[model samples]
Target: MATFGVLVFPGSNCDHDAYHALKHVMNSEVKFLWHKDTDLSGIDFLIVPGGFSYGDYLRSGAIARFSPVMQEVVRFAEKGGPVMGICNGFQILLEAGLIPGAMMHNEKLQFVCKNVYIRTESTDSIYTSGLEKGQILDIPVSHGEGNYFIEQDGLKSLQDNDQILFRYCNEQGELTEEANFNGSVDHIAGIVNKQRNVLGMMPHPERAMEKLLGSEDGKPIFESILNSLSVA
Candidate 1:
């Protein structure tokens, strides 16, 4: 079985959700490691789950980036290991300097929670392999600061590199301005690192793993990573 490590930080509310979703849906061995731990060898992949780390005190993920575990996460990413962040996890990745751009407060200045429709923009990522290009997936989102921001040149570089893996859209799967939950630039909802292994997105794919939760689109994402690891 593929060994997956989920980082656990103080105030992380989504660790169990991610553990259950990945363990059950992927049938993979999921281990929870404290944010203060250093070594991460033997783990095939890493996931930074969502929640208010450090009570989100000094910025969403600012303090957590300094955690002992993140040092290893940064090293792992440099070694080509697949890493991912979701919701607050995304903020951490930004603060960790794992991916380009930064997450800021919602342009509307309100916490948005709903089933967001995101179209798969790229499948080159290890996490989006099961998704077809242009396919629409309904994922639930709950966060206050998810507005993905980047300078114009940086945005162009990301687009030119195909780093954008998913884009927010409407019910018809049409990219619209209003459907942009956090006013992310260019409607980008998800993105991967230059190596295409590190992924960050605002939508909670774990939360959508069960029908009882109002959606099941999250399964494919976890499956994608697991499948990739299986093949590896």
Candidate 2:
């Protein structure tokens, strides 16, 4: 089994949720990596879960970016280690420069919490390897600042490199303005780094691991990561 490390920050409420999903639901070994911890020994994968790190002070993830463990996370990612950031974690990745683009307040200027549909834009990354491109996942997104923005050139690069992994979509997997829950550019919901080893997304895949919790669409993401490492 692949070993997973879930980072825990002071305001990281979803760390436990990620732990439960990987350790219990997915039946994988899981550990908690404290924010102050700089070591990542024996960890096969790292997950930065959703929550207001540093209480979202001075902007979401702005303070948490300098956490002791984050330094290691950046290094780990640079070395081609698999890393994922969800919701507030996504913000942290942006601040860490591990992922491209910036997150802005939802265009509606309000906090959003609800289930949404997202279509897999590419399966080239380990995170989406177990799924087919264009697959639609029913996941929940809860955040105040999830509107992803980037310069036109960066957008072109993402498009050219197939870095876009997921995009908000309607139930039928259609990209529509009404389905753009957060007004993200190109309805983007998730993306991978240039190396495709790091990913940042706003949806709570951990919260969707169980069908009883709403949907099991998130399970494939974990399975894909585990399966990829096992192959390697």
Candidate that scores best on lDDT: 2
Cα miss at 20, model 2 (Å)?
0.5
For model 2, the superposed segments whose C-alpha errors exceed 4 Å read none
Local lDDT at 175 for model 1:
86
Q: TM-score per candidate, in order?
A: 0.97, 0.99
Tell me the TM-score of model 1.
0.97
lDDT, model 2: 0.95
Best by TM-score: 2
Candidate 1: Cα lDDT at 151:
99
Cα lDDT of model 2 by residue, 1-232, tens digit: 6799999999999999999999899899999999999999999999999998889999899999999999999999999999999999999999999999999999998899999999999999999999998999999999999999999999999999999999999999999999997899999999999999999999999999998878999999989988898998
